[model samples]
Target chain A: MAWNLQSDRPIYAQLVEQLRRMIVTGVYPAGSKLPAVRELAVEAAVNPNTMQRALVRLEEEGLLYAQRTSGRYVTEDNEKIMEAKEAMAAELISGFVSDMMRLGYTREQTIRLLEKKREG
Target chain B: MEEYLISCRDLGKSFPGCRALNGINLELPRGRIIGLLGPNGSGKSTFLKLCNGLLTPDRGELLVCGSRPGVESKKHVSYLPERSYLNDWMTVEQMIGFFKDFYADFEEARAYDMLARLAVDPAKRMKTMSKGTKEKVQLILVMSRRAQLYLLDEPIGGVDPAARDFILSTIITNYNPEGSVVISTHLIADVENILDDVIFINSGNIVLCDSVENIRAKQDKSVDMLFREVFRC
Candidate 1:
């Protein structure tokens, strides 16, 4: 999962975003057993408490499920995962484009920059 | 499955010139989120420390997890002091390792994973991290344990609005369902919604101890409003 130190958003939300991306990209396949909270905390260099919050949010969103003493696993519904990823990506990009426009970037300039980055 | 996670009888403590806690009695049930609310110099932290074994009571008996405060209680109780207790020289990774060594229930992998998510470098020394970052790191370590009880002293104090939400969500999500957590803080509004039970302390005395639902029903006002009415400072 990507943890952006410079991002204005909270770290737990960023972690959730990364997990969603991974699930949508088929990195952590649907219905797969995810790493334990402790292991994920160590790898992320964060407190287990923060990671636990992210996991709980994901569970609430139906992207993950927990078993008694068995740990969390990716949800079985692949379509739901993809839908959430799409919605989140749209929300993020829209917010960026809106902010750019508000900062005086023309629609053409924004599109051109987006195309340039996509090609690069 | 202990009957009461914490049971105190006529608990009291006093210094030479001041009585910090006087004739205080409290019973905290297992598997509940209890808030210890009080004003400054109200002995809220002192009471919590007493329960966690950081301070000894002058009189009366205290039992945590059905046993007196000692090595066994120390093992079962995880405490986050009001101030920074971590060695300034140690890195985040080193601190995790220290906890792993000291508390057998501490999960190293969990702590590291949380640090990574917060973009906190294990290699960076604690002395360099910002005050808020240090608090976050300490919270991660304390919440990582599978202890029977957690005594968190002002976990949300001095944090930004977003950070407060982060800390609260972490506490709610990480704590064991069967274990009890005693959160000592004056910022009652921040946590009032999530607390299963609220214990209001005034001048070292417990004025009220009841479920959030019961308090709301009885007072007919929100916790924040009640808090203001009670403290009024």
Candidate 2:
């Protein structure tokens, strides 16, 4: 998965986002085993500690699970994966709405634009 | 095992013309990464110094591993100052040798590996390197150890974005997992999420210290936003 350091968000969050994107995009399918922490850290040019943090965060959100000696693996539950995707979508949309409001977009105008964009 | 690795009781410090730190009480447990955040001249550096025994408290007691700072404490603590403390005349190898001499816990091979990753030549003198490069070298040296407590002051403050990433990655990859780290920096947004716990300091007083999850759930705001609201001045 591609990780961008230029984003204004925290690095661990960015790593999480990209890993989630990979799962949704079918790059890392359900029941797949993720890379080792040090290997991923080297790939991302991030610290293994930070990489572990992202992995732990994913584990906390139920997107991934850690096995005793098998390392971190993708969650096998499709329902949970769908729920995580929905939650992420809502959070992203809310963040966008706040940005639009800050940029002086009215609620009515936002609704109209969203409708038009959806139709086209 | 002790519940906390560090415990401070009414810790205070003052400069000739300024009160750097006021009465402060803090408890830091082992295996947790703490982000010590504050604005400029807000006593972040002074607090780190107090814990590292570089600066003595004026009004209270500070404890590390259940004792005051000294030779015994020095063996367990590794620190990286905000400014350059390394002599310019020495090369990277010499610096490694210095650490090996002073700190029995230092791993010279690890230091060389880290430097190699950054393309830092061991034979080059510190004075010959740029500011950012020198800072990276210093960070590599400090992190190449197995100390119990690491106190890093503005570890990423002097570098470019890429260099900052490198420095951060080095920290994550090298430090002992079970040990505690207290990083002092005003750049909260960049490092907020990775922090297991964060202690907000303002004007030498601790305003808040909590886990990232609790802060977000309770305050309904990210740590970065909270920092902006708290330190807007």
Worst 10 residues of 2 chain A by lDDT: A1-10
**Cα lDDT tens digits for candidate 2, B117-159:** 7888999999999998999999888898888888999998888
Docking class of 1: incorrect
Which candidate wins on DockQ?
Answer: 2
Which DockQ values do the candidates obtain, in the order shown? Answer: 0.03, 0.19
Interface RMSD score of candidate 1: 11.6
* Each model's lDDT: 0.81, 0.82
Candidate 1 per-residue C-alpha lDDT over A4-41 given as tens digits, one digit per residue, 9 for 90 to 100: 42222344655787777777778889999999885675
TM-score for candidate 2: 0.79
TM-score of chain B of 2: 0.95
Residue A11 of model 2 has an lDDT of: 58
What digit string (tens of lDDT, one per residue) describes model 1 on residues B9-120?
9999987887889888888877677889988988988888888778899999899988988888889899999999899999998998899999999998889887887778
